[model samples]
Target: MVKEVNSQELSQILSNDKGRVVVDFYSTECPPCEALAPLLIELESLYSNDFSVYKINRQDNRELALELNVRSSPTLLFFDKSHEAGTRLSGTITVQQLIGAVVDAFQVEARTLIVPDAHENIWDVLILGAGPAGLAAAVYTARAGKKTLVLKGKAKSHLELAHLVENYPGLPPLSGKELLQNMETQAQGFGATIEMGDALDLTFGHDMKLVTTRTNVYKAKTIILAMGKGQHQQTIENEERLIGLGVSYCATCDGAFYRGKKVVVYGNDEEAMDDALMLKQLDCDVSFVSYCKSTQCSETLHESAKKKGIVYYPDARVTSLSGQATLESITIETEAGTKTLEAEAVFIIQSVPSKSLLRKTGINVESKDCIAIDKELRTNLPGIFAAGDITCGGLQVAVAVGEGVSSALSALKYLRQNS
Candidate 1:
């Protein structure tokens, strides 16, 4: 069990001059911190003797948090013999990442606590998204008695954000939230499980498809792509070439790799702001490049960032990325003039098309980055279907629902024949 410690107790523990220590500075009402709690509990259960684990409420212990430079919730600090050890991990972290941090901090090997094989939970139909297309597909598949599962990403669906949805059939005009709630209710009533998490990676076998998230893995006999459009893809030079080399879309997944390095984040959403704060906690030279107007960001975030002394570039856009083999600098177009900023890494967070997931499965996508699907909503790969905005179908809710039903029928047929 992880013990809750105040600043005084924490300072005393850190200065004990014995035993490896792991301190977690967390906050209430923080989703990422909530998600990290279970993993931390499991870690303590597995390595109680190797290290001592403690938790501190950042909100209650403001002075200690400031002194320790814990600017983000769920900031983890490792210590060895009264000295800091290893790099701190902030934001959402996977089990593998946690283990790696422990090894780096204490030189202790993980004997147990292995991640269960993703292939363990093999559903008849595994939907890659939980948008209109995915939820619609689940309604059909679950009614047909096929084990259906939908992986809902952290990013809210475009439809969910819409203020009103007027044209969905068999329903009166209602708010987007209401329409989605009805769909979710219908899907769940039919015995479908809608799990919330992002699909971090996907792999295909001859008969099975494997999907990985930060905390869990899933398997499906048939897969459906209803992930909607990609809105994050910016048309910057050398962006594609530097994907793993430097350019990243997820700060939580890649921020640790650039500890104490120069990094630039381009976006105006909550996720982008959170990423910027996380990088700052890791001692990275962080800069915020907001494409939105100055008033767009929340006052809390804007003020907190300013207080942290993070550089801000409002109303700016990245025009190009320059590097030989890896990213070296980024050129931004601001109101003042075009300027190049020296950056070791660039993180662009936005919504774009879901083309990369399609490409990974060897599925063909059109020139406009839309997945190609037949009238039946089936892709080139057997037992795999595409629907919703991802297929370049009309962006209307009614159209996505129709395509979702069609794809579900096609998937049902494929499953019956294979069985």
Candidate 2:
């Protein structure tokens, strides 16, 4: 059994610890945390002498959560010799991943090594984003009998920020988060290994491409540059000053923290409507501010917002985002006059540009912002491919799905030809 510790006892325990320890900092309420708890207990029973597993309630220890800069719940911390030095797994993790982390953290041979197996150096496909497009690609690739790995970038997927997506086919008016959950589960169900991390840098050579994240480096024979645009930063006073304070891009990830609070969605695009609806679900007084001339939100989204009494401020440009230490309010420039709206959080949606990883790697982008590609979806770089918003197609879920399927087939053909 893993010993549960609180902040009051953490200092004392760390002071007396002799060997390796794994601190599972988790909240009882989170589903992913709950999913991991039993596995962790089993690991504790399996490695009693080599390591000790301890649980810390994040809610109980505000001081500890702050000290460790705990961003999300159910985070796992591995302390080799002392609690002061450690590595952490935030959000969700798998048994295999956790085992690998333990092996690396404790410098012990993984239990799996007991069985000798042939090392097959084959990663049939490597998709670099987890948005709808990337997820779609993984599903198709894995279904095609290829070993696939998906490296999820930040934004998780721009599709995820959307709150209500009535336009996505088959799924009847689902929240963006729920829709993304289905996509993720589908990809996972098809034997596609989804790794939660970012591909910080990408490089292509004659034979293979290398993607380096902060945690690890992955090599692939063929690469899909599905990493869509990193959100454009809102250049407002104190906006940069108060990033984690209240300003957030991910509603599902952070909406619960600001329950019943006032939040503003900045943008006139479909994603803005989606985010506004998510905030509304948290019982927050939601408002949508659009700088765009016309709001492109669907009828379902507009009706939903209207029924919820969420306000819409069109032709409004946020001149400044201000707060003392956290977000306080946003100043908007309108045709009438400059006005201020008090808000605890601001969701900047217009920053969703298309060029990202492909740009950095020198893949040709056209004037219309589509990645220059043939019908095959292969970029100028021979082994590098692109799909979804990264291409010149309109940013819609249906288009992304079709592009993803096309890209996967094209990549498979490329791999087979070279192999």
Candidate 3:
């Protein structure tokens, strides 16, 4: 069992304990923390004799959290014999990632307590993203009597953000949200399972694909890519080249790496402000750079930054990143003049397409940075298909729906021939 401890108790326990230790810093009303609670219980039950698991409430142990440089919820730290061990994991994490961390830190082989069999967890078709294309594919695949599942990404669909959609056949002018709702209901009526989650990693076997989320793993015989246009990639010079060196996309996942270091957060969304606040708590000098005008930013974020004493730059744009091998400083263009700030790290938060996953799985992409598909909507990889905006087709609801249907039919044919 995982025992809850306060700051005072934790200090004593860490100094005296000589066994393997894992402490979880979590918060109330955090969705990621809630998802991790059950996983921690499972881990404790399996490794109770080998290691002791403990939990600290960030709300109650704010001082301890500051000292430890833990800035985000659901942060996991590993220690062996009172000394830090292994790489720290934050944000949404997979079961495989947690187990790998334990094995690396303790040098012990870890196994899952409950193992699911192939027949129990495998689906006939698994679709990523819940946009118009994905939902349409689900309708076709499920109607063909195949078990279909759709994993809706955390990012909202571009179509859903539209206030009105004027041109579509067989229906009156309707709101984008209304059309999307109708499609979703149609897919569900045909017996498709839709779940909301983000895909963290993808692994492929000879005939199967594995998609790992923070809270669960999904296996399928065939897969479809219908994720919409990639999120805005950073336009600053050397930004892409410095991805893992000193540049990060997910602040919650990499905040600990820059503890106590000066960092710049370039975003205009709520997530960016949350990262700035978290970094401030870790005693790091943080600057909030909004690409939009000051009045355009969320009032709540603006007020929160003011109360926290974080430096704010309104209507600023990152022009370039400097440093040979790693990021050292950034040049920003403002209304007054160009200014360069010394920063050890930079965080650019935005939702991008799922192209990274495709690259990892050895799928071929076209010149336009999209998955290449044939007339039948089949990708170069067998049992895999591409559809919608991910294929670089015209950005229209009707086009996406047509591509989804074609891809589903091709997938059904492939399965039948192989069977």
* Model 3 RMSD in angstroms: 7.7
- Candidate no. 2 TM-score: 0.47
lDDT of 3 by residue, 160-193 (tens): 9878888989898899899999999999999999
lDDT of each: 0.79, 0.71, 0.79
Cα-lDDT of candidate 3: 0.79
lDDT of 2 by residue, 267-356 (tens): 666656877887787789988877767445444456666877888776778888888867889898888999999998887654323343
Q: Can you give the TM-score per candidate against the true fold?
A: 0.63, 0.47, 0.63
Count of steric clashes across candidates, in order: 10, 2, 2
RMSD of each: 10.4, 11.5, 7.7
Residue 230 of model 3, lDDT score: 44
Please provide the root mean square deviation of candidate 2 (C-alpha atoms, Å): 11.5
Clashing pairs for model 2 are 163-274, 370-392
Question: What TM-score does candidate 1 get on C-alpha atoms?
Answer: 0.63
Candidate 2: count the clashes: 2
